[model samples]
Target: MAFADACNWINGNVNSNLTNRNSIQAICYSDVKSQFGLTANHVVRACARVAANRLTAKRKRRKVREFKPTSFDCDARTFRIIEEGYLVSLSTTEKRIKVPMRVSNYHIGKLQGRPSTSAQVCKHRDGNFYIHIQLKSDAPKLKKSKNVIGVDFGRRDIAVTSTGNSWSGKDISSIRDKYFRTRTSLQKKASQGTRSTRRRAREILKRLSGGEKRYQSWLNHNISSSIIREAIATDSIVAVEDLTGIRERTNQKPRNKTERRRSNSWAFYQLRAFLEYKGIKEGVKVIAIPPSYTSQTCQKCLHIGTRNNKSFKCENCGNNCDADYNGAKMIELWGCSVNQPRGSELLSCDINSRATESLHLPYRKCR
Candidate 1:
C-alpha cells in the first residue's frame, strides 16, 4: 500500500518538475511517512526512486500517463544478509521479515567478498518470489583495437561481417520452422476440437511459447561472442547498421504471411544489444550507422545498384557483389567516415560514393 501511495504521489507531482530527490522529499516525504506509516528511510528512498524514474521517463519523452507503479525498491540500509548467504533481513511497512534465499555459486562469485548496494524484491508471473541484488565492482580495462569490422544482420544469413565471414541461420531457421508447425497444429486442435482438447492445446502452446525465445537468445550469445572474438583478434572495431524501427518498416511493406512472420520474429535488436555489451567488455568499439541504401549502393563505384534476392549488380560500374556483403562494406565505410577527424573532406562523401576507393581492391563479379 505504501508503494502504491508513493507511485500515486509521484504521478501527481510529475508535471511539477519534481525531479530532484531532495526537492521531492521536501514536498512529500513527511506526508508520505505519516500517512502510509512508512519509516523515514523508506520514505526518503521511495521518493528518490520515484523522482528518478519520473525524470528518466520525461527524458525519454514519455508522458505521465505511461508511468507504471514500481513493485518495491529497497536500499542497502533497508536490507541485510543475516545468515552469511542464505537469509536476507528485509524491512517492510509492517515489520522486518527474515526471508530465506537460494543463491547459486555463480551469484556468490559475483559478490566477490563485496557488499551489495541495493535490492529489488518482486514476484514473477510464475508466483515465485525473487530478489535482484545489485553489486558494485571495478570494470576491467579493455584493450583498444585498431581496425574496424562491419556486421550486416539478416533473416537468412543472421550476420555477415566486413571480413567476409558469415554466421548462417540454417539451424535457427529449422528450429523456428519446427515451432511454427507445432503452433499451427496446436491452433487447429484448439479451433476444431472439444473443450478438453482445446485445453490441452492451450497448455502445449503456453509450454512452447518460451522455447523459441530461449533458443534465439542462445544463438545470439554464440554469434555475439564469436564476433567479439574476431574483432579482438584483428584489433578491430565492430560496425553495424542501425535497425531501429525495422519491425514497423517490415510491417508496412508488402510481405506474404510467412515472410511477415519471419521478419517480425527475427531478433535483429537482440543481436545488436548482445554485440554492444560484449563489445564493451572486450574493449571493442561497436558503431551503428544509418542503413539507408546500404544494400543498393555499390562499394566499388559511386552508383546506386539493383538488388535482387542475395545479389547486387551495379550497371554504372559493372560491379557485382553479394547484397549482404555490400551492405556490410557500406556500414564499415560509414563507420570510417564518422570516426575520421572532424571537418575532414571524407565526411562529405555521398552514401553511394566509393568510400573504400583508396584501398584499391580489384572488383570481382558476383557469384
Candidate 2:
C-alpha cells in the first residue's frame, strides 16, 4: 500500500474496531498496492513491524516488562540470517539469506539473543526457527521408591550421607586459599592508582571468569556423578536442604582483590543445578527442604536452639549434631512433605519445607 494510505489505514484501524493483521493479510497484495501504492520496501518494513508487534504482545501477555525494539547489534549477534537485503553500513554481515537454504543452517533462537549453535532445525507455523541441539545426554534410569538419603553440606564439607559417610572439602579449602593469595596481590597492586586499578580489575575479572568456568566444570561433573552414583547404589531419594536464600545472607569479606575475583568464580548455583538434572536423568528424586531449624533442631528429638557456629545441641532430643547436618535433615523432611498428595497434606506435612523439583535435565554446572 502507499505509505500514506498504509499509515492512514493503520492509524484508523489500530483500535479494536479496526481490521487486524490477519484481516490485512487477507487482502490481495495487488489490491493493496493498487489502492495504496505500497512498495515492496513497505512490505519488507511491514514484515518487521508485524514480527516486532507480535513479540511485544507476547511478552506483555507473559508479564515481561521493559520491552524494546530489536537493535542492529542484537540482530547481528544472534540471527545469522537477517535478510535486510544489501545494507550500506559496516554493521551488516556480508552473508546473504536466499533460496535453496537449508533450514538447519539457520541458527538463531527467538529468545535470549544468542546463537542456536547447531545445524538442525524445526520450523513452527509462525516461522519460528529452532535449532536441534542435544540439550541432554541421557543417563540410565533408576527404580523409584528405593532407599532415600539425607545429606549435609557446609563450609567444611560438600556432602554428608545418612550412612555416616561424608565428603569433606579438600577442594573447596584449596580453592579458597588460592583465591586469598590472588586477592591479596590484586589489592596490593590496585591500591597504587585509579587507572592501573581499573586495568588490573578488568584483567582480574577476565582471569576469574576463566578460572570459575574451569572450577565449576570440575566440581559439577565430579560432584554430580558421585551424588548420583551414591543415590543409585542405595536406590534412595537424595534429600538436600534448600539453600536458596544463602546467597542473600552471606556477608563474607575477601582478604584481597584477587580473592574477591576468585570468589566470583565460584558457581554456587552449579552444585544445585547439576544435582537437579542429575536426579532427573537418573530417575532419582532429589528434594530440597526447609532450611530453618535444620541446623538448630535436633535430629533425634526435633529440638530447636542456636549453639556454636559449628555445632548445635537440640533442646528437644538432645541430639548433638553439626549445624550443617541439621540443615540436611530438615531438607530431607521437607522433601518427604513435597511428594505427598493433597494441598492439605502438603501443608500439613510441614511449614518449614518449600521445595522445587525438575525433570530430566543434563547437569551444566560448568566447573
Candidate 3:
C-alpha cells in the first residue's frame, strides 16, 4: 500500500519535460514522504529516481505515465548484498528486511567475490519475490587476430559466414508460421465465440504468448555459440553488419501479407545481440561495418554486380557464386580494410588500378 502510494505520487509529479533525477527529487522528496507516509527518505528518493530513469530511457518513443507497485528500486544506501550469507538486505517503507536468495550454480559463480551496492526487489508472475543484484566489472582486453570472419544475415539463411558455415532460417520460419496460424485462429475464436468458449480461448492464447519468442531466443543462443566457437577455433575476429532500423526500412518496400510478416518477424537484431555478449564473455572481438553494396558488389572484381534470387553474377569479372557467400566474402574484405587500414591501403590502390584499367578509366591515387 505504501509502495503504491509512492508510485502514484511519483507519477503525478513526473512529466515529459521535467525528468531529471536531482531536480525531481528536490521538488517531490518532501511531498512524497509526507503524502505516502514513507519513513525512509531514501525510499522516496528511489521512487523519484526510477521515475526519472524510465522517462529518460528511450525518451523519444516511451513515456512513463504510471509506475507499477510490483517492484522497488533501491540505491546504495538502501540495499546490500551479503554474498557470504546468500541474502539481500533491502529497505522497506516501515523498516529494513533481510531476504534469503535462491540462485543457480551459474549465478552463484558469477556473484562470487563481486561487490554490489544496488539491487531491485520485484515480484515475479509466479507470485514470488526475487532480488536482482547488479554486478559490475571491467571488460577484458579484446584479443588481437589477423584473421577475420565475416557474417551475412539474411531471410533464407539466418547467418552465412565467410568460411562456408551457414544456419538456415527454414526451421524458424516454419515455427513462426505455425504459431501465427494458431494465434490467428485463437484470436478469432476469442472475439466471436460463446462466453465459455471465449474464456477458454483467451486462456489458451495467454498460455501461448511468448512460446514462439522463447524458441527463437533459444535457437539464437545456439547459433551465436557455434559462431563464437568457430571464431575461437580459428583465432579470428567476427565482423557483422550494422543493421539498425533494418525492419523499418524493409517495411517501407512493397510486399504481400506473408512477405511482410516474414520480414517483420526476422530476429536478426536478437541474434546479433547474442553474438556480441557471447563474444565479449569469451574474449573474442566482434565488430559491425556498413552493409552498403555488400550484396551488389563482387568480392573478386569489387564492381557492381547483379543478384538474382540466391545467385550472384558479376559482369566485370564474369564471377558466378552464391549471393550470400559472395556477400560474406565482400564483408570479409571490407572488414579487413577497416581492421588494417594502413596495410590495406596499398591493396586497395592495386585493386582500384586494376579495376580502372580494365574499364578503360583514369585511375586516382587512394589516400
Which candidate comes out best when scored by TM-score? Answer: 3
lDDT winner: 3
> Each candidate's lDDT (Cα)?
0.81, 0.54, 0.82
Candidate 2 Cα deviation (angstroms), residue 202: 6.7
| Candidate 2 Cα lDDT to native | 0.54
> Candidate 1 at 52: error in angstroms?
10
TM-score of 1: 0.67
Q: Higher-lDDT candidate among 2 and 3? A: 3
Cα lDDT of candidate 1 equals: 0.81
lDDT of model number 3: 0.82
Ranking by lDDT: 3, 1, 2
- What TM-score does prediction 2 earn? 0.49
Give per-residue CA lDDT, model 1, range 148-196, as digits (tens): 7889999889999989999898888888989999999999999999999
Off by over 4 Å in 3: 13-17, 34-45, 53-66, 277-283, 301-304, 312-321, 343-367
